[model samples]
Target: MIRDILYTLDSPYRAPLEITGFRFGKGEKTVAIVGAIRGNEVQQLYICSQLISKLRALEAKGAITSDNEILVVPSACPYSMNIGKRFWAVDNTDINRMFPGYDRGETTQRIADGLFQHVRGYSYGIQFASFYMPGDFIPHVRMMETGFQSTSLANLFGLPYVLVRHPRPYDTTTLNYNWQMNQTNAFSVYTNQTDRIDEVSAKQAVDAVLRFLSRIGVVRYHCHNGFLASVIDEDQLYSITAPDGGIYRGICHPGDEVTRGDLLGEILDPYTGDVRAPVVSPTEGIVFFGYAQPLVMEHAILYRIIRRLHG
Candidate 1:
């Protein structure tokens, strides 16, 4: 099927937001995948568009078919996307934070309302993007404690790691939280940092989704080798912070693997160029993330060591 442009929200003051997607096959297992709810996440939009294109090609060749509908909204916030910002033009509110939105609310709220309304009928939902957190990413799925279905889907996504997050009561209005709360199942998969997007991370994400859809019978392509069956809890994370305030330098880049007590970085006295103290790894693990900037504060996170034993 040729992909369709469902609706375009025009802005006389700026460029319009285009909601584009494709639907294929027919059955009870409808799925909705959205990306770039935050405007600045162009990488996610591009990657989701790529996925959409590939799925369309496969569907046309009869190489792919879904038991249920698959709806993909590749770029959700066009105005923010056009401006390369993360918030709506009207109030600068985060659309993701204002989910299950009211129809008569602000512009972004209206957009959220529309998305929530559209996705509610689906059996499963996924929101993909790069996050605002610092440093390189280790692919992970974030879920609310909705039920076993959320857990199963998170495992099925096959990311290198999984984060089983609890939806803080305050976060109950978020897309995933609200959907899960209302008996609809949804999960979020993402890389770290909205500002930096890498090809490796993007490819990993697409691979994860390919496997997920395959398992769900959304497509026929399957690669069992890519799945990472373990789920990582918040406790598994260990942070290595700077001991003193100084000009900081990291010994390893994000995504590098290391053993316990490995040298992570160092702090230097800015004026004298003297070594302040070395920041050592807290545990044997991969440097999943860290601060990229050269400056530091006492207790600033110089590196995030996700214990190797967990992997």
Candidate 2:
């Protein structure tokens, strides 16, 4: 089920890089699911591979019922994947940050341009990603204002949190924005932490996607109830900073729940044998995320709190 497409690039390097996709079912609606724009996010690529294997089996047996198209790009950044780095080999640049792409530019731009061209015809575009930087994430999907289809897909994906965010000013060169400009339905699903495979985030992503496929009628399946995590608005998210110094963190993980005034962590001055100050939770809600490294500094974010907004 692996179909390799070589996009011709203007380079002395003759053979085009092999981009692989798993094609399944037959329909007017095509969904291009891509992963590993950042080489470090091998987990996303792995998830895509799993999805393709299942879908391909269904296709072979005639059990695949979706009239819609599902094209899976398991790894977009091959160079990065090879080097175990996050950027392209020619010049170390972030592929995700570079959107529409330039034909006359470097490797990152060329790849973006190539990717944009290949996915332009799709009805829905999904980009799977994890933090190219390592950290725990509250699983979420980000949809662009221009992506009506993406918004719908985000809901269908049924992730715990579906957030509609404008592509940051710096995100113009990303695949998501390029899909938007081409009138292709596009959205991005992401988890926190980079360079390491997080099984929890991967499963959460797959779960959301399966729910989405079912909701769109692209596939038939029974989704377990209570599948989504609590989706919160960005405005409701607040970060608690370390006021003092020392390795400070309380008994809290990324997804733990906390009440207001709960002791989240503390900064200590071991040299002076002093416990500088304790960082406390500001609201009663879930601990959406926190820093992982131990060496602390003043103004370092210890935790991000998502307060329940009163309606």
Candidate 3:
């Protein structure tokens, strides 16, 4: 394994900020995996570190195939990570929203530019991504429906779900969308948690990546055939929102099955502890995501369910 700084910038108050990458095997630029663009994405970072560890063992044993290379970048924004901030510490900007970025633009843009330069042109690009909201997701492989997206390729990861999302205006600036536009097969792997490490899901993610690599002949690792992924469009999800701002009390979690009108959660008055609203399922389906935080605002999305289809 070869460890190198992928990009670096001078810091006025402290040490230079560096984005590091670990390279395994030699030859073709087969795959690039990124993790933790946001500081709070502890799970994403953990998954990448575990991937690096596993790749190191595979490389040491000559398990990595010749003529194929894999790059694992564990963290891109360590400065924010150091302070436990979610975005850039100085400007409160998101590195993820500055992709395919401008070299002469703001700090996050510059960092994105430098990093994208190094990661682009790979056969595949995989990002361990977190949700925009505080929630838990059923582990899935998500792709942007950028015309270049291939659900068949996404299924190789073997995750339980393959979500194809339609890109909005702001999505054009994201790493996954830009990678797809640039001819790279890009995928975003979402595990259950963002801020905290979930070992079970992390192992599932690592094994899924290994399974993909082995299936593509990049490595010789053996792993079980994961789920035959259920391909779902992002629009198909049923979103349940909080009716009033209050303390949230959720009874169901991601991956739970619920029937129509089932009690998913309830909102209580922050001071009085009286029930403010009861959140219920509108359709029989699997919980794809559930808000994990204890407090919520009115109209805040509480759950996203994958509505079951009848025969």
Candidate 4:
């Protein structure tokens, strides 16, 4: 195992910020795994760390293929993580939204550029990604609907779901999208939690990565065939929204099955504790995501369900 600083920026008020990467094996740039572009993505960071640990063991045992290389970057924005902020501490800009960045643009852009220079050109790119909202998700592998996307390759990870999302204008700046544009097969792996570590899901994620590497011949390791991933388009998900702003009380979570009209959750008045609204499932399906925050605003998305098809 080899550790090196992939990128660095000298900070005026603090120690120099560095993005570190861990490398295993020695030849082709086969796979690159990234974690925690945002500060609050503790789960993402944890998963990357676990991947690094596992890769180290594999490398020590000569399990990694000699002609393939794997790079694991555990954290991209440690400064924000240190201060408990989600975005860049100085300007509140998201480093994730500045991908394939210009070197002369801004702080976040420069960081993105520096990191991208090192991460791009790999055969595959995997990002331990978190949602923009605070919530829990059913573990899945997500890919942008860029012309380069390959669901067949994504399925090798063996996660429960493979979601193909249509990219919006803002998505063009994201790392995944940019990597795809650069001809790299990019995938974003989403686990259950973002701010807190979920050991079960973390292990699942690590196993998934190992499975993919082994299947692709990047490493030699034995792991169970994960899941025959259910390929779903992002548009197929049913979004359940909050009717009123208040305290959220959820009766179901991600991966739960629900029927139409089922009372999935309720919103209560923050002060009086009276039920403000009852959030119900509009279709019979599986819960793909559930809002985790105690408080919510009107029209906030409470759940995303994968609508089940019936005869």
Scanning candidate 2 in windows of ten residues, the lowest lDDT window is 225-234
Work out candidate 4's RMSD over C-alphas.
Answer: 0.8
Q: Estimate each model's TM-score.
A: 0.86, 0.85, 0.98, 0.99
Q: What are the lDDT figures for the candidates, one per model?
A: 0.74, 0.71, 0.94, 0.94
Clashing pairs for model 1 are 260-284, 285-308
The better-scoring model by lDDT among 1 and 4 is 4
Worst 10 residues of 1 by lDDT: 129-138
For residues 1-311, what per-residue lDDT tens digits would candidate 2 score against the true structure? 54757354444663456566667777764688888788777777877876776667666766556467777888877766876777776777887776677768877777777776676788788888664333466777876665454444566677667665555677666777778787777878876645666777777677677677667667665677434445455555888887877866566877788898888877767676467897888888777767777668778777877776567
Per-model clash counts, in order, read 2, 10, 0, 0
Residue-level error in angstroms, candidate 3, position 293: 0.7
For TM-score, candidate 1 versus 2, the one ahead is 1
Model 1 residue 107 lDDT?
A: 72
* TM-score of structure candidate 4: 0.99
